[model samples]
Target: MTERYSRQERFTPIGPGGQAQLANKHVFIVGAGALGCANAEMLTRAGVGKITIIDRDYIEWSNLGRQQLYTENDAASLKTKASAAEQRLRAMNSEIKVQGIAQEFEAETAEALVDGADFLIDGTDNFQTRFVINDVAAKIKVPWVYGGCLKSYGIVLPIVPGTTPCLHCLIDHLPQEGSTCDTVGIIGPAVQMTAAYQSAECLKFLTGHSMTVEMVYADVWGREYSSINISGLLNPECPSCSRDAVFPYLKKEKGLKTAMLCGRNTVQVRPDQLSTLSLSDLSSHLENVTDRMKENAELLMFHVEDVRFVVFKDGRTLIHGTENVEEAKKLYQKYIGA
Candidate 1:
């Protein structure tokens, strides 16, 4: 280690040994939005050996207010969040390895993305993805940090497979549907507070330090902070982490077929099974019905009236200008049937 990490290494808990351990650890992060950007940047600067982060969305003007590792130019260019994050991370630290994949994190691919990770981070905006992460973590016995923020409030929980209660145990308490950030609005401080707690937990876990089995809650604007012990929430009959675990979220039927992108008037539709779509061929086929059709190696973008469609290689289509799942599905079917 050089003088670069001297300040971090000087900290007693992490010292030289913990720093070394961190340098050899691999962290898998899902979602390259606000939380992911903070977590990945902190870990990258702290010299984490490797990082693999995935995101389905691209940068936007709205994201710039809270999301790091992205700029106005990135949004203008419609750079995928994953690609932008990877570029910034590599520029931050050349000593470590960083891989960014522009893809959706669903049941079919969750296991593979998290396979070799030493730790996992929840940077996703939705709970469906978190459930998948919880299932994969429980089944594989990997520890993960979960964090969420909305409207000046945030919550964090560090989950160790067997030791701590999994997310499913607290499902009843988690809001399934309510006013989201899109409706109520989110503040920057809340996002940072959540990410800070998450990063601290990660440092402790990766450095071989014991972690508390509790959920931390905070409202930065409200000036409130509290934590709850979730040890009692561990259900004996829990589907995710109980003795007879089923890993229900990993099943194809339970996977998300349609998701509304947070704060965006967009809906994403994924096929039941992934298919390799030839963008060139699809672009050619869509020329008759679509306008301003554009094709690249990875994706194709076009417009049908006011609705914008972005089709990916894995048979996933993002229907912008509307959040209606049925309408998005219809558009997908009409434009690119897989």
Candidate 2:
């Protein structure tokens, strides 16, 4: 395994120098689901010096089919995605620094999340979180790779801040939850294809190589592919990329506390006021409810009446098995004492 990166370095595009450049860089991946795990595995094997993975969700049996980094045990034990990915990546490449933070990505913590990072990679399933990543990346002038997979199709774009059109210019607004990705089921190939393209772009950008490719679109199962030149799509009136620096999505009013998840049939409710909730204490209290409960460093998860509750240290909740916002809220209040 010591010679793992040899073949990669031999590839002329990313020769020894580029490999060295990547060896000194730090990358921040915003999610640890399908795309996030794939990218992390690629970059780690490629010899990226440091990687920080931030994710809010935990592993489920369904995630094992495409997420790549987790085993059935990870899912059965209710392991946090970020932490699990970190453990897997480190096991694959111990020379690299792999740190995982089990936290939700939102406006309040977006800036700090990208701190000291050379590049950002978007693996988030929702546009709201993607927009927050874009806003934070744009504010810091950090280049970010945006990749999304839905059904058999996927989209990949490299946003270089002032160099290229941002995500806001391409998609003006995010779609409503449950109707977005849940309706159009994604395949494993689509997720891998998108993340491969995204990881390639990330390596190029990190090594100071030129990116000649514009937006990449692919329908792996359909055997369709296209390279779109989106230079004309730049919106000067765009709030996130208009140079005005007033990110509309980053604003407090622009965010919603509770919303339905795209494909998970879940609703996430985040408290506006931050709290110092202790997962350990919460674990002690929830132990009587169900023996299926699991506790990670910053997460406490359990099941009640066929409903799954994933509670965070910051007083956020991702309730699975139902998309009803009110119903999810009631469950959170009942189980989490929020």
Candidate 3:
């Protein structure tokens, strides 16, 4: 190994053997936003062998404030966050292998994306994606660290398969109502602290070191931190762990048929028709209708009906200024040739 990771390896907890183990481990990070970017950078610097990052959205100007992996140019180019993060991480540690997947995380894609991973990390912004990750982690018996942040507060928990309570055990069912990063606004410090906690647990798990499996709640602004003991919360009647819920999220039994991407202010619609569109081709075509047509290999950004459309090649488009799937679909059809 190079001297780049010498400082991390010198830590007593990791040592030489643990550092070597980490160098051979592979982790899947489910989001490329705040939590995802911070965790990816830390683990990469810590010498984790391989990392697979998955995200559906592209970089935006707003993301540069807290999403550390991206730059102004990346945001201007509308680069996929996962792809941008992978590039930065590789430069940070060339010895580690990094894969960036600019794709949405769903049940059908989870197995293929997460396959052969030693561990998983939750960097998603929505409950739907978190639940899907929980189901996969439970089924595969892979341990994963979960983290969430809002305002100046955040929480972290490590789920070690049958050892600790699963996500559903704590939330039971998805909250009928919730405030997202866009609605409530998230502080950069909260994201950083939460991701750091999650990264610590990930290091502990990979190094075979002991750590509390309880939920860690942190308030960065208040300078307060607490660990909630959830060891007893594992439900004997829990559908996911105890009864084998059959991964409903993957089956589409749960999760929204229509989802509004938080922060991006875009609505995602799930239609039966599976069609592919080249962003470059679409942007060229839309130039006639709007003068704001801009295209990259991964995404296209355009304006229609006072809303900005940041469209990906995989038929996933982020429509800014509205959270209504119907409206987004209407705009997509009208401007992008459907």
Q: Clash pairs of candidate 3?
A: none
The full ranking of all candidates by lDDT, starting with the best, is 1, 2, 3
Q: Pull out the clashing pairs in model 2.
A: none
Query: Pick by TM-score: which candidate is best?
Result: 1
Best by lDDT: 1
What are the per-model C-alpha RMSD values against the true structure? Answer: 1.7, 2.7, 2.3
TM-scores, each model vs. reference: 0.95, 0.90, 0.92
Each candidate structure's count of clashing pairs: 0, 0, 0
Per-residue alpha-carbon lDDT of candidate 3 for residues 53-101, written as tens digits (9 for 90 to 100): 9988787788888999999989767678877898999999888899999
- lDDT per model vs. reference: 0.89, 0.86, 0.83
lDDT of 2 at 127: 85
**Cα deviation in Å at residue 200, candidate 1?**
0.5
Cα lDDT, model 2, residue 176: 54
What TM-score number comes out for model 1? Answer: 0.95
Residue 22: error of model 3 in Å?
0.5
- Residue 284 lDDT in candidate 1: 85
Candidate 2: global Cα-lDDT? Answer: 0.86
Cα lDDT tens digits for candidate 2, 1-338: 55878898889988888888998999999999889989999999889999999988888898888999999999877788888898999899998899999888888888977889999999888888999988888889998999989989898998987668898888878865444567768889999999999998999888888664489899999999999888888778778977776987778753338867768989998777768898888888888888888777667778887988888788888888997888887887788765
lDDT winner between 2 and 3, please give it: 2
